[model samples]
Target: MNRLSVSRLFHLNNRKLFQALIARYSVDTGSKDYIDGLVKDDNVVVFMKGTADQPRCGFSNAVVQILNFHGVNKFSFHNVLEDESLRQGIKDYSNWPTIPQVFIGGEFIGGCDVMLEMHKNGELIEELNKVGIRSVLLDRIEEEEKK
Candidate 1:
């Protein structure tokens, strides 16, 4: 075969091999109902790349920091890196193709960029307030205003 045809054949074979491997290793993710329950079960749920204490990605770390900055220490976090199914499942479930998804009061709250925007605009404070968890930044601002 010509060089171009040989390369094309090789690429096709590689693609087939990759597909077979994926099919063999694919895992069954939790059902949509299960994901719904999990997100709603907690006031704050974060589907990130790693644990809250040790985030695997910068985006995940930013999310953890954002939550901590607001004095939100007691929240639920699922490490997507540990579960391939969860990694894909959450993206599919939220219809948001990104890691480090944040949920508040059982509502889908977008990813790191959205969180940063909310934090800057003080919208995050209001959302937290709705769930009965006050933001510490609000108290700091109030204290400064009183002085």
Candidate 2:
């Protein structure tokens, strides 16, 4: 066979393999429900590239850092890299095509950019207060004033 023919055959096989993986990893119908439970059960949840202790990507790490800076110590997190189905499923669930998705009080807060903006504008503390969690960052400031 000629080089062109062999190249065409290889491309065809690669396309077929890609389709098969897509079919296998497509979001399950119940994935939305699963994600719903996860978000609602936790006041703060992050669907990130890695676990909270060890974020795999810069975006995910930025989110972790922002939350830590705000003194948000207790929050749930899921590493989308661990599950192919979940990686895609979360995007579908949120209708937002990105990793490092954040949820506060079961509401979608958006990705790292949004979180940073909110933190910068002082909106993050208000959001946390609405969910009944005090921001340690703010709490410390208040304590200092009382001294």
Candidate 3:
């Protein structure tokens, strides 16, 4: 076969392999439902790359820091890298293509960039309150100022 034909065949095989893998991980409706439960059951949920205490990536760590800075320590987090089904299932579940996806009160908030922007402009505090979560950071800071 010619070089062009060989390359085309290789690409075709690769595409098929990718599709199969995606089907294996992405078609488990049970996993997707489980993820949905996690999102709705928690007031704050972070679908990041690692655990809350030890994030696996810089972006994930930044998200963890953002939450911690806001005094939201009781939030739920799912490490996408831990389970292949979960990693792909979350993307399908959220219809979002990235990690560090944040959910508040069962609402799909944006990723790290959105979190950073909200935190910067102080809108994050309001968002938290909308979910019945109080930002202790601001209250603590105010208390310190009065001391």
lDDT of 2 by residue, 33-111 (tens): 7789888988999999989999999999999999999888789998999887789888999999999999999999999
**Model 2 CA deviation exceeding 4 Å by range:** 1-30, 143-147
lDDT of each: 0.91, 0.90, 0.87
lDDT of 1 by residue, 1-147 (tens): 999999999999999999999975563554586688879989999999889999999999999999999999999999989888788889889999999999999999989999999999999999999999999998899999999
Cα error, candidate 1, residue 42 (Å): 0.7
Model 1 alpha-carbon miss at residue 49, Å: 0.7
Estimate candidate 2's alpha-carbon lDDT, on a 0 to 1 scale.
0.90
Weakest lDDT window of 10 consecutive positions for candidate 2: 24-33
What's the lDDT for residue 146 in model 3?
Answer: 100
Q: Which rank order by TM-score, best down to worst? A: 1, 2, 3
| Error in Å for residue 55 of model 3 | 0.4
Between 1 and 2, whose TM-score is larger? 1
The regions of model 3 sitting more than 4 angstroms off are 1-31, 140-147
Q: By lDDT, is 2 or 3 better? A: 2
Report per-prediction Cα RMSD to one decimal.
12.9, 11.5, 12.7
